[model samples]
Target: MRDLNVCIIAFSSTSQSVNLYKILKNKKYNVVMIQTPCTISAGCARSIELKEKDLDAVVNEIKQNNLEIKGIYRRVLNDSTRRYYYSEIDI
Candidate 1:
């Protein structure tokens, strides 16, 4: 099966997630605010979703902005089973 080129950034605060979303959007990055996946335990229920290709740039932006993040995760979808598997990414 093919993998979806998506990554999620988990934050400990909702405000931080929204702030990052706005920052990325303003920079013309395709990002979305989504509910933090159950697999990830975070203080905030919200997270930022972006393409895997943009992961490096996003992380750099986060560093530059001094934003706090709980963790980063990459999601893999099984086409045959229609299930999603998540793996934590070490940044």
Candidate 2:
């Protein structure tokens, strides 16, 4: 199978994460609430997950609303090794 690439939006606070989840859900975006990965230290335990293809739109939504975020990341899951790799996304 092909690798899966996901976009992770880390928030400074749990409330911010949940608020963004709500906003995205209401806007009909496919998103999920997730625990922040240990590799990312800037955010709280809660974060938001979405498809990599939606990253730009999500980022735009965040900016248009002036929501604060700790950082953004691209997570890739290797199907063969069953390992996940993370990289910070510049925004």
Q: Say which candidate scores most in TM-score.
A: 1
TM-scores of all candidate predictions against the true structure = 0.90, 0.85
lDDT of 1 by residue, 1-91 (tens): 5568899999989889988999999999999899998878746899998999999999999999999999999988879999887788999
Candidate 2's clash total is: 0
Worst 10 residues of 1 by lDDT: 35-44
Q: List the residue pairs that clash in candidate 1.
A: none
* lDDT tens digits by residue: candidate 2, 1-91: 3436788888888888888898999999999898888888644999898999998999999988889999888887768888787778898
The C-alpha local distance difference test score for the whole of candidate 1 amounts to 0.91
lDDT of model 2 at position 69: 95
Question: Model 2 segments beyond 4 Å from truth?
Answer: 1-3, 78-81
Q: Report the poorest 10 consecutive residues by lDDT, candidate 2.
A: 1-10
Residue 28 error, candidate 2, Å: 0.7
**lDDT against the true structure, each candidate:** 0.91, 0.86
In lDDT terms, which candidate is top?
1
Deviation in Å, model 2, residue 37 alpha carbon = 1.1
Cα-based RMSD of candidate 2: 2.3
